[model samples]
Target: MTAGLSRRAAICGIGQTEFSKESGRTELQLACECVKSALDDAGLSPADVDGLVTFTMDTTEEIDVVRNLGIGELSMFSRVPYGGGAAAGTVLQAAMAVATGVADVVVCYRAFNERSGMRFGGFASTLTSMPLFLSWYGPYGLLTPASWVALHARRYMETYGVTNADFAPIAVVDRKHAATNPDAWFHGRPITVEDHQASRWIVEPVLRLLDCCQESDGGVAIVVTSTERARDLRQVPAVIEAAAQGATFDGESMTSYYRDDLTGLQEMGAVARRLWSMSGLSPDDIQTAFLYDHFTPFVLMQLEELGFCGRGEAKEFATVENLSIGGRLPINTNGGLLGEAYIHGMNGITEGVRQVRGTSHNQVDAVEHVLVTSGTGVPTSGLILGRD
Candidate 1:
């Protein structure tokens, strides 16, 4: 399938910050205020950014946010490691550095305070300076991340009986689209299925503290140029029709623990079959989605590894539609990372550039296309975005 690449690269700008646990600032001032509000929403400044991409568990660096956003000359910069699976591979490394001219506007960011400052669910042993294959599962307890997603949600509920009320309809459809998304930190707090069977578990029959995801501070950014300079910039572009990153065999960043099939994520099914064969589109042309809910059973194992429900039938297609707000597909409407605010997926790629720029709060009506995924049992990435 892979036929779509025509050197496109859009998403002219998008920014974020206010999802907080306490952004009393500094993760380099939430990465220079989300890279100066994504270069003031791409009316361009910081001298039209030269290029930068982020996340190797970002702590704000890329020449210190290009010497604190007084940006100038940087042809290209990059980073992408497993945490939150490098959120759409930082806009696929700024759309392959602006579709190969090697950088024009670029920028892609992430910032963090992660719950007032470094808390990744606090449980440290400092794995003896990691990497010796994470010192064989950091001395067995598999450290945190809810016990490495409760060992693949207990082998996907013993090879698919998938219960805990089928992952409580993906945390009740991401807190019912984060209760109408007032930049959701469970904005207006929605949830039920008896509030995910009376929340709090954290890792028993798979997870709960509302099925994880929080501890945010904030920062998000986007820009990436070229689709004819993002059709004369300042918004509505969003194109980059496909981008992927995958890692399957022996992949480990969230500890793959010698996979055989811990209920399928196979690096997001190898980034959803290379993002539906490089965006020649499928999954019914994606009218909106954002997958990486950070925990909620890896958002039903990434909707059955992005074929949108079939492996174990993604908990019966997320309890018969209601994937929140008039759902057939509508996911993470901006309340992902289970109720929006997990800088690691860069605010779900800024809500997939606001659902291809029709601008979302929970808007999913005609959304041309929009897949956006990342952070699913590690070594993952995906993106599709559309509306050119």
Candidate 2:
């Protein structure tokens, strides 16, 4: 079922810049700094990094980073498209390179001034470079990520009788975890369901302000290498038990309206199947999850898509006691795109690594396998990580 890349590559290091509205530096600096931080965490230097991967939306060029970090001739350099969806795909690219001997060590990074320079949530007058699927929605005034997601969110809510209230717990739990994470932008700031209900609607009847993730200015990076090489490095390695990327039939970016239904993320389901097949693990084996929480309703959809719950049952499965740290399946312990900084889901992967290392601030108990997912409503990707 797999190409035999599973567990051959492991994430050895993780690092990031402060989650903030303003970093006061160029995205290039943020990119270089985070890579250096990850390299430091892995006890490796720039020269040791022979491969690199990042998002197409990222402003920092590969050559600039390579030159700034003093990295030597690179064997592999890749750019995964699809904003938010490229998070785990970056790991997939790095892993494939490492597993096939194309490169020995690879660093995956993402950097942007989302809040200060280019806000992902802001209305785009003309995004010519956006995915072709997204252009379809612009004619209807779906000019922002929030507006685009609102279409599916409203459809899912209507199909299942789900309400705006059911999505509040996700935000509450994320902020609860962020309240304890010193590095989170919303650190020490936890909100309640009542607060979420009171928050003004971003897309009325579909999403509220609290339900939307912050547009953060930050950078995050991960180091991938052979399991053998990772074991000999600094931190405990988060073995890549499995990694997968999927784009479903008729799937479109943000607006997957052409599918059989709008209730579930078909692409995410495809990714879940491959992760299960490649890892030889079932949903019951996942001790924790680092789900992408760009929107709370999507978090619920991801839970169902990942097989954590039956379709339409996520409304009941996502409880305060359950999503919390000592619960059946704690998630987003480092805060998430919602409560932490939204570095296009790269921060979620970093938190997954911390969970595997058993060093997370809101660490779960005996985390054996951590499930990390990319964005929803798009060609998404996912990863299954475990202790080596």
Predicted candidate 2: what Cα RMSD to the true structure? 1.6
Model 1 Cα lDDT, one tens digit per residue, 317-381: 78726576677887888778878777777787778778778778888887888888888888878
Q: Put down candidate 2 lDDT per residue, 1-388, tens digits, no spaces.
A: 3649889999999988888998999999999999999999999999998999999889999999999999999999999988899999999999999999999999999999999997877737646566565567776777778887888888888988899999988999999999999989999999999999999988888899999999999999999999999999999999999999999788778877877688888889999999999999998999989899999999999889888899899999999888999887898998898888899999989999999999998888888999999988889899999999
Query: Best TM-score goes to which candidate?
Result: 2
Instruction: Name the regions of candidate 1 deviating beyond 4 angstroms.
Output: 1-20, 26-28, 33-49, 52-67, 73-90, 102-105, 111-162, 165-208, 219-291, 294-298, 301-303, 307-309, 313-341, 347-372, 375-388
Least well predicted 10-residue stretch by lDDT in candidate 2: 123-132
- Compute the lDDT of residue 108 as modeled in candidate 1: 84
Off by over 4 Å in 2: 1-3, 125-135
lDDT of 2: 0.91
